[model samples]
Target chain A: MAKVNRSLTGTMGRSWLKDAQFTPLAFLAPTIVLLVAFAFIPMIWGLALAFTDYPILLSPKFIGLDNFRRLKDDPVFWASLRNTFSYIIGTVPPRIILGFVVALLLNQAIRGRNILRAMFYFPVVAPLVSVSLLWQWMFNTHFGVINGILRMLGRAPVPWLTSSKYALPAVMIMSVWKTVGWNMVIFLAGLQGISPSYYEAAEIDGANRWQCVRHITLPLLRPIILLALVISTINSSKVFEQVYIMTGGGPGYSTMTLVQQVYHSAFQSYEMGYASAISLVLFAIVMILSVIQFKYLGARTDE
Target chain B: MLRKFSVALSTMLALMLLISFAAAAAPAELRFLWWESPQRVESIQRLIDEYEKAHPDVSIKLESIPWDEYWQKLPILIAAGRAPDIMFMVSGNVQRYAEMNALLDLREPYVSQEVIDEMYEPHRAMVTYQGKISALPFTLTTVTPFYNKDHAAKAGIEPPMTPENAWTWEEFKLAAAKMKQAAGSPYGVGLGTRDFWLLPFIYQNGGAVLNEARTGSAINSPESEEALAFLQELVTEGIAASPVDQSVGDLFPAGLMPMSFGGHWDMARFETVITDFDYGVTFFPQRKTSGVGLGGDFLAVYSKTPYPKEAAEFVAWLTSAEANGQYIAENYYLSPRQGAKVTYPSRQEEMNLAQKQAELASVRLTADRAIPAWDKFLQVIHSEFQMVMIGDKKPADGLKAIESAINKTLQ
Candidate 1:
């Protein structure tokens, strides 16, 4: 028995239990356990739930692909998916471009640059609930500041939050204002990291400011921009708080997003299976979009 | 002398041990959970203190969650077997919880039939599920028309003070228009578009939202269509504030609207803020019938509570006339008890009018409204009706959509 124990611990399992690896593993055990318990296990369970009929009151029954089959015919599900995509398209590019432009302007020695940066960042730091409420008031049709300005200019008041035609756009505008600062700060960091000598060399070649930015700055910032795009698209696809607070996805189902639908299905309707199915579809969309972004942007970055 | 002193010390030690054991074994520590406004929470806490003082063998740990998160967390807690011994429930959730067997039936053995029958008819209906008393109604919030007196004076309209004097639907509309004409645009009637608030109109129009058997939709009937069209016209013609952009609570208190629909609970806030204008509560206008929406909280015992008998007794005590009177008087909320005595600190006239409205109110339940999925149905209702109110869809089309959606939920 003693000889067998020596061989097991000393020969085969010697490196596996070595101090170097064992110490790090011991240190990481808590985090790994937490991730498995909270994130990984729930993810696997959610995927399994998508294949069952779980109303949360009774025991779950395996229903195979019925949930997915139902999704194919669910109009609300289709509408929410369309709205999610529209939100991604409407908010992500404008945010990235505006953030970049603002970053570039602030990168120069301008008056009150620090104050301007802080002013831009304030909205990002504000609590989303308060910001959504503030924007709701600002978008009020009768006495809102926006309408106040419109009326002052002798123009008709727009029912910004109360109309289906403009609700999503209003949400998009608030989202951009609230989040542009985050992207700006990221782009500013990327811009500052670029070597000044590259710009100097380009300038010596009689390159204009636009050409210098076009060739050197844009190339250097490609990876950062890709990072922002992937992050923003994933986050924007899950939009809920603003739409929930501002319009409650209302005036019709015009402002409903995929995550809000998930909430409605799971909590409001108590259909866990259907909600999981919706979530699985959302997960696939986000994953595929991220992969496509990487495929295109990553290739350019490498060059 | 030393021996005597040692004996006395031993005796004292023995007595101390006995007292500590009694202290540890006493007090069952029942967990009570509820969702209410801060003012009501204080009132509930006082009731808990009074109950604890009266029953020396029991103590309560109070848990209050905000209304929005309460329903979402409650079923999960009950399913996990971690439910509170006593829980606050609403009328809409009573049927679902009873069907789930999560609530204790307060029938014969737990509560006598006489006591259950003693409750107001609508309140009794709210708690009854398949002839079983699922919960006992404690307080009620009934809708009444709250009007700005100054606006009414300007429009030369006397608000209805009694059901007999209630205006017809056409009269109500003409009055609203006159008020708008006198008091500028957006200052007429402030209407709420949610289904619960909208039910009064349907009821007054002699249209039921669901069939008699509660198996299908009755909202597509001509009566319902006319009722909905009338409401839509109020918004579209600028006789009512746009439900989309303005909250009636805000507009009413700001003196911007001549009249608005509010509940007994809304009186507290309105009383505090409407210093610029005097307001009065009265019966809602009548058409084919005189009716308004009825809703409130109920006290229920968790079926799985280890101390079921104690929990039931406590819930009974909490809803008793004496305890309910104290709570109602302090909060200005209406009691569900038939003859509960309560004295308002002020505004007795308005309170009396509200009480009259509640007495006329009926508890409206449909097959879809009683299920766990009713919240989703209400969301559909809100969206569909909002489309009509915003002029994107006709009332008939919206009603059709609602009918189909509700039938789908029933299935």
Candidate 2:
């Protein structure tokens, strides 16, 4: 009877362990299932579609590498690529710098500091489409607020959105304005996590505010900076809503971006295969940039 | 245990029988799909209600996707062989879906001669892909000039707001210049530099965006070049609104533009926004002849639908004189049905002008321009035209580039 009771208890213990192991998977099943359904399957399907002639209504035909090869001579695609890179180049650095500066400013115990921080972070929470349209009104030549001010200063009106010369610059300005706040918040978190002992030590060593930031704050904030940089770069690369709402990729395609091209090709042109190919390239570019960020500016204990 | 098992089995058997019986009793369902504006939804619901009341045994399901997602979602649905029974087709997209054999032919034994004849000549031509009608138009945009009467009075111009007294091309230019000089407005006229907007100028010059049979672009012809040059001249000389600097939205409603080449459909918005100034509509300015392009929402029955005849009957009823007329009056567009008169309770002049614009336009219109590759054509021309207007490309070079790009797209 004792041996029988012992055997029964052992079996119960083994069953309990099995249930414990399965509980985590049961909890994770929802997320894993969701990711598999929405993300994994779509990624594989898109990559598969890139090699075919899938024009939505028509049956997809396999024509391996033709879509990619066509991209070599495609001027619009090249132009959109150039514009996207230009957008990244134009907007990212300014955002990082402005965010760094603002984050540093907000970190200090200034008067109404919380209010000022909130004010700076407002644009981040605001919808991009609404702000883009607001910017459109401000950039209008004959009637915009900016041009109105320009005229008040006796300067000629600038054709901000309607000309290739100024449309991108205008978009960059809007992007910087819209994005800097989110970067600031991320950076503000990084700044708060930083120890004040380092600053005090630097102060004792006769370091000024600028020097303290240069030697201590910046070095400490490298990981956060890199994080912000990668996130912002990735976000800007996929810019379409703003471009669509503001310019519609017009004024001679000066403001066209890769995602916008993807949207147009997929929906308007119905060349889903080509759109998928362009998207794959965009995905590759983002992946490479992210890898580089992680490789070079990843977290280090010393820093 | 056996008692519980027996109870469950009986329940399962009962459920299956109940489901089968329910299926047998279910009415035939037809799904009607469309991209909706707020007003259009109400109108569609009313029409659906009317149709349902007429046929008690058949149920109509109305589904509306927002405009932005409709294009992407509809294609996926169609590609999966689960297309709506009836789908709303646009001018530029009709040829594409029709070519894919996704739409039923609304011709011969399916539609009567009287119903076909009731469709305006241009609208009739538009829905006929290859030789069979694939869709029936509901309401069409016939291009005409919408002018601010207060600005016209200030400019000391009579400003012919009638089809009989429609401005000639030279007269239109002079009117623009006069409006600028007299009112001190920045731009005399706002000509939307979009491809659809530029169609009137091309039509006015007897040039076309495509060759017949829809093989290649015919926009590089001498007439088209002349049209392009004239447009460039207007921009460079600061008569027409610059494509980049200001839009019709910025110029006209702001009391800065005297005349703009727009369509009757824009009247509703103008009525609301132009409170400071009074406006009137007129026929598009003539060159070789007065010209307008046909653009409209079309109703198409899906080729694979089980209720093809029923869908066709619903569409025919929806676009008929009684329905189309009432629909246009409510929705603010010109009816595509011949002799369909829509009376607006307010803004009757806008309705009257739309009718006149349709008359002037429908006589010499074809949907050949709204080919499968029309989007590509628009992209090419709009970019080149902007470049030309902005002094980046010479007019002839722009036309040549546009021609080359279009040919490539066609290939």
Top lDDT: which candidate number?
1
True contacts kept of 1: 0.54
Model 1 CAPRI quality:
medium
Give the whole-model CA lDDT for all candidates, comma-separated.
0.83, 0.83
lDDT of 2 by residue, B1-411 (tens): 999999999999999999999876786699999898878888888988988898775689999999988988898999887899999988778878898899999886677878898877877777778888889888877665778888788878887767778788788889899988877887888888666677677777888777765688787888988888888888888898877553556577667778887766776667677789888776777777667777888999999999787888888888887876777876578778777767875678766876777766633335766577777556767788888887777888988888888888899
lDDT of 2: 0.83
Cα lDDT of model 1 by residue, B1-411, tens digit:
999999999999999999999876888879999898887889889889998999988999999999989978887787677899999998688877777778898887788777897787777766777878889888877766788788778889887887889888888889888877776756578777566677778877888777876777888989888887987887788787665663445777887777887676777777788799788776787886775767777899888788888888889889888888877766678878777667887787888878887787755632234554466577778888788877888999989988888787777
Best by TM-score: 1
What ranges in model 2 sit over 4 Å off?
Answer: A1-21, A299-303, B1-26, B161-164, B245-247, B347-350, B362-365
Off by over 4 Å in 1: A1-20, B1-25, B363-368, B371-373
Per candidate, chain B TM-score?
Answer: 0.91, 0.90
Clashes of 2: 1
Clashing pairs in 1: none
